[model samples]
Target: MSAGLLVAVLLASALLEGSGWAGGVGDGNLRLSVTVNGRADSDVRPPEVRVGTWVVKRYRLLNVSEADLHRVRVLDPGAPAGSVRCPAVLPAAEEAECTARFRAVAGRHVHPVRAEGDVPALRTRLTATARAGYAGVAGALGLTEEVVVATPGTGGGGASAIVTYTVTNRGNLPLYTVRVEDPGLALAPGAPDCGGRGGTVAVLAPDTSAFCRTTVRLRPGTYRSAGRASGSDRATTLGTGGERVTAPVLTAGASAVFVVREAPVAPVPRTPAPGAPAAGSSAGAAGASAGAGAAPAPGAPGALARTDTGTGTGTGTGTDAAGRPAAPAAPGAGAAPGAVPPGAVPPGAVPPSSVSPGAVPPAPPPGLRRAAGVDDEGFLGRVRRRGREAAEFGVATTLLLLLIPAAVAAALLGSRRK
Candidate 1:
């Protein structure tokens, strides 16, 4: 009977050890642990991540109970579907591994991973939390420049131009202490009003723009100008322990041409005097007035000179009917002839000098003189014209020499035939 009892005790101990119930009634338990970016959740400090970057999460599910687990699954609510993968079955005293991925967001984030499984006599569930801190430190800047030109009107003033600088934050972070500058252009007093901040922008948000404007007076000419913008990322400055980190200076350029022309002057009208002969009247009235011994009106036909038909006692004006001053009387002839002779001077002969000294000479005929600055040719134009003439002359000379050879050959052939 004692031997049988010892055999039974050994058999019971083997059964308990095989069933994993030796420590007591084996309980169904699942323990879940998570690691973020290779850092365990039990670490003193959370994992660090940059905003907009991918975070790798590793999950480990261990079945510590004596009962085998079935239909085992791991899940993270924040992660997308199919991002976490693991085996469906877990045996007693066995561990399973899973992986999940998610994008890090701004600020602190709490990620919870849970494991669930079904046992023969009990259901098991476990939860774990992984914390991460994300920082946004990347920044980008953009700049653009525009110019508007205004010309002077009839009212006299210099040409004016308005220049505008547009500063843009192109990154995912806020930019601080934004400044814009233009070295090639002089700004007006109290100029560069960037949102009334005078060329400075306190804060510029992502994907937004700010405008800076200044006015300048310019002469008539062409202008080329460029603008530069610079700013620092707020998060980057703080993350780097107060070490200032600035974005690359952005540059934009624009060119424009301006011309200010002088205004034209208007002419004043002239009023005729009272009781004067009307302009463009018939010549018969002028002759009748002269026959009546009345002096012709100024600016009337045949009003320049007059001669009397009475006896010649040198009482008549020494002028001909055609209004030309008479030539000197012939030798032995009277001082003033009775009637002035016609056809006195040959054709093309120059008349006697009638203009006094210090009198301004009459302007040359339009057909004989060219107006100043009208159809004028520059030095280059003259050079091109002379070159063309020389080319033509050379071509003519070559043609003449070729014709001479042909003519001589023809003449020689004719002589031989004769």
Candidate 2:
């Protein structure tokens, strides 16, 4: 063969292989058998299906060829055909099986499926059918409210009350104009959807939903509100659709209690105006006696100094050597020069008069003197006493524990004698 002819043959073979056709097209070669729910011609057809329900179709591929089959695949009507279960290589006199699954669409319709593959050098094709039906559109709506009371001192800004309503398409068919309505809030005219697009949705798939949010400024009181949703069910015949059937209006409501309290008041500090005279001075005193004046500014040194100076004026108390006011003395009281005050003793000094009548006094030659009624042994004596007490407690505890068994034995003996 010429080189060009050989290349043409190779291209044809590649196309056939890519298409996954294995056996010859005519009968007496590879055969194809299709079944729906395991019955080719049954009294009952496949049951009706809603959106999202599965429509299952099984396919069996048998190889009449004496050699193994390769490049085998099952093709269905829809893109991404469901799942296939078959061995790559089909030995002679044996068969391989696969399943094609289709998810129900929004309306009644028929879906066609087929399989094609190459056994060895020949091409083969098999066919099957699947049907899906819808049960009309129905829906349910629910509304919920979330309320948060503002904390004291946090006057405003955050959302205090929020109402959310969900519109769900519970029917088998797709829905249109899915929107929520609220008596308390301003919704878009002609029923506005949650997306706030101001236009109806072309299609809301079955078992799906949309959420509408409305916010309100809640005062310090209880709140109650109601909302509802509306939508139109889609109707389709054959391959055409878009006919709308009005669905029943769904109503829901929510109630929330929002509370707010008055903010707290903080005391303001008083500041003396600039050029104002110092407090508690003659000017401050004059201002006070006039029945109109602010109190002395707190923590001012001048105010404290004025108060201390005022304590000595017009009083009979004399000033001490330290310049502090002295305590008043009795009428006949007299003191020698450099003498300490009565009833006051120098620290760590012993007074002669404080000694007991018959106690022997220490000689003056010794710098240190022994005090009466002082315990010489002191801390050591206390420690020895504590140690003796601890030993007695240990002995008592040991005796008690040792006598318990003896007491029990004696009780048994007494009972036996009885």
Candidate 3:
């Protein structure tokens, strides 16, 4: 062949090799096809999807040549690693499939899928590519609101309550300019903290929540309050110029019921009741009168004059009929001190003038003795008498012990001297 003709032939052969068609005779080849959202690429229109929705991509690979394909791989940039499922080896004249998934975003999206394999019999590589397209639209706007109230305990005047509002985005799109409002109550200062700048929650993403808290004063009664949350799908301001756009507002509401009670009162104390005179004064007056008027029976105790009945004359010196000094009266007895009643002085009784004023009174006759601890000497007086006697006995015993030792020493000295 001529040199010019040979150059042209070589150029044609290079192009065929670069295009994977040089050794097309009996060499293995792969055909790749892709679908987006279950719609094939040859369809007239692409699949329409909502933003944040799942976009499913399917890849089909066919071994068109007479030889089997080995070490096959399917790759998609939009899908995560190990998410594309495909067989490692594909038989001749057979088809293999792969599936991958990704989330859709606002605007049109194009995804390219690639299939590659090794042809061992021909010692060559085969590659094929296909693309799928989908269009994304704006999602629905939705919201949910919840209100919680913390009521105060019993208090004076009206007490403050802590009100919390929880707003949640329940749809696939983000919400903007979220705010809470209550018509029946006024919020306190430095309140409505929604974890945003200036106590406002500007945005809430899909399926997420934001909390706002405020304070309000409530009286002592049952209160029912409702709170509404409103948000829009687009931001109110678009650019640096502060241009405002009107968007559809979505609202949700919830109500809370709570009660506040009143404080309790204290009680007052009572006064005591009235009654009688003391025993000492009545007994002394009765004793003086009875000493002059009557005497008790010989072996019987005297009956006390009734002071409450006003029957006795409470006057006169405390002396017996024979002019002897009287014995002291017992408390509450009201009897004459030492006077004997008419038949009380026995026939042979001693004369009063014979006994001195300071002399001790005679003991009662045999069967009329007083009980133990009931003597005329008071309990404190008896205690004093016993204490003096104990002191004297102790002193005498100590002197005797000293004298006995001295006597024994003196006796020993005298014996030695003799």
Which candidate tops lDDT? 3
- 2 or 3: which has the higher TM-score? 3
TM-score of 3: 0.37
Ranking of all candidate structures by their TM-score, best first: 1, 3, 2
Predict model 1's lDDT versus the native: 0.62
**Which residue runs of candidate 2 sit more than 4 Å off their true CA positions?**
1-28, 33-47, 53-55, 64-68, 79-82, 101-109, 121-418
**Which tens-of-lDDT digit does each residue in 1-418 have in candidate 1?**
9999999999998777556456322433577777766656423444545455576767788778666677777767655688888787787778988777767565445545567777645333333333332233345678887888775655455577788888888777778888877766655333688988878888989889999988877755566666667777745222112223334443334434444444333456667689766666658768867787975433233444333432333533356666566654432233232222334323443222434568865655564243322336678877887799999999999999999999999999999999
Answer with 2 or 3, whichever has the higher lDDT. 3
**Candidate 2, 1-418: lDDT as tens digits:** 6999999988997675555443233334344554543443211343333334354545667766554556666655432344655456665567877765555554434335454445444444332333322221233334454444545444333334555565666665566666566665454453433575542344577677666665555445444555655565533221112223233444445554445444455567778899776655877668567744443333222222111221333444766668877665432124332333344433455444566779876553322333321235488876886799899999999999999989999999999999
> Which lDDT value does model 2 have at 56?
50
Clashes of each: 0, 8, 3
Candidate 3 per-residue lDDT, tens place, 1-418, comes to 6999999999997676555655452334689988776677623465656556677777889888655778988877655678777888888778998777777666666667678888775667778887766665542443333344444444345556777777887665688877776664645433577875433568788778887777666667777767667777762311112233344567788777777565433345544345444455688768777875875433344454422222222432255655564554333334454444444444444434446889976765543443223355698978987899999999999999999999999999999999
Least accurate stretch of 10 residues (summed lDDT) in model 3? 235-244
On a 0 to 100 scale, what is the lDDT of residue 316 in model 1? 36
TM-score to true structure, per model: 0.39, 0.29, 0.37
Off by over 4 Å in 3: 1-130, 133-158, 168-175, 183-199, 203-210, 235-247, 250-252, 265-388, 397-418
Give lDDT for model 2: 0.50
